[model samples]
Target: MLPGPRRLKRPSDFGATVRRGSRAATPTVVVHVRRTIDQDPPDFTRVGFVVSKKVGNAVTRNRVKRRLRHFAGDLDAQFNTDVVVRALPAAALEPQRVRDDLEDAWARAFARAAAC
Candidate 1:
């Protein structure tokens, strides 16, 4: 699990990140990356996850979410900006695929962010 301070818990934050941030999508996940604002800790990068009913029932959704959280926690040290990862239905079927897609999405999203 990610530490509380490193998690994006507000609805408004999720909305803004998805609306204005750079995005990248792969087969199983989509990633949004946004530069942190002045009020946020200069060295801390927050992460949030979106696993909707469309991805699975409650059990499956939670499983996917847990998997994503673990992966995000591991990758947290590498991120310099806020990130939101949205899981697709495909993510419920294969953990390996989800991990691969998340990495790809992160790379692409950050690359786009860097270009701006």
Candidate 2:
């Protein structure tokens, strides 16, 4: 599980990331990353996961979320950014593949952020 301070908790936080974050997708998941300029500390990054009913029942969704959180755990503290990872149905059956995809997505997201 993501630590409390590093997890996105509110509906608005998800909405903001969805609305404004730069996005990248793999076959099994979509990623949205939003960087903020005035965020305090300047090195905290928060990560959230979204796995809907389309992905699975509660048990499956929670499993996928746990896998995603585990992957996000490896990320170093970066500039203030909020990232949302949305899992697709296929993700329910593939943990390692999702992790590989997430690694690619993170690379792309950071590259995009650096351009601006």
Candidate 3:
């Protein structure tokens, strides 16, 4: 589970990050990354996951979300950033692929941000 401070819980936070953040997509996931300047110490990045019904039924969606939370927890070392991860339907079908895609998409998201 992600620490409380590292989780993006508000709808406003999700909207703002997804709207303004740089985006990168892999076969199983899409990641939106935004650099933030508001947190007091900003030692850790905030993250949220979106696993819609399109991904699966309730059980599958929860499983995918749990996987994403685990992945996001591992990536929280990034400071002063907000990340939203959206799972593709393929994510429910390929658990291993989700991990690789999450890392790849995040790197690509930052690369895209840098290029902009």
Candidate 4:
């Protein structure tokens, strides 16, 4: 069979780097992050996405995943930490709405991480 897409092989490469090394959340999504303190100089970090069927049908789920991936890629430089974003059912409301919520969630997560 043919090989899968290159992007699928490197999931971690698509995530952002928040200021802190832990996870946080908001109303729209749940961020789960684990820092690698063991490594002398950490290697590439890892990230994953989790969206439930409640979000919508297969197509809708794929669309949401794509949006999250895009957002993660775009925000990679803004943060300096690893994150796994779990999309909430509310995220299926609208593209822009979901984006807005995700942004808000990220901000909250960053702030919480900073506090710790």
Clash totals for all candidate models: 0, 0, 0, 6
TM-score versus the correct structure, for each prediction:
0.91, 0.89, 0.89, 0.65
Candidate 4 residues 18-110, lDDT tens each?
Answer: 333456666567765544344462344345577889889999888888888777655432334456678877777756676666677666666
- lDDT rank order: 1, 3, 2, 4
Stretches of model 2 off by over 4 angstroms after superposition:
38-43
What TM-score does candidate 1 get on C-alpha atoms? Answer: 0.91
Location of the lowest summed lDDT over 10 successive residues in candidate 3: 71-80
Q: What order do you get sorting by TM-score, best first?
A: 1, 3, 2, 4
Candidate 2, residues 17-112, lDDT tens digits: the string is 889888888888888888865545335788888999998799989999888998888965346788888898889877669988888887787667
Runs off by more than 4 Å, candidate 1: 39-42, 76-79
Clashing pairs in 2: none
Q: List lDDT for all candidates, in order.
A: 0.87, 0.81, 0.86, 0.60
lDDT pick, better of 3 and 4:
3
RMSD of 2: 1.8
Report the Cα lDDT for candidate 2.
0.81
Candidate 1, poorest ten consecutive residues by summed lDDT: 72-81
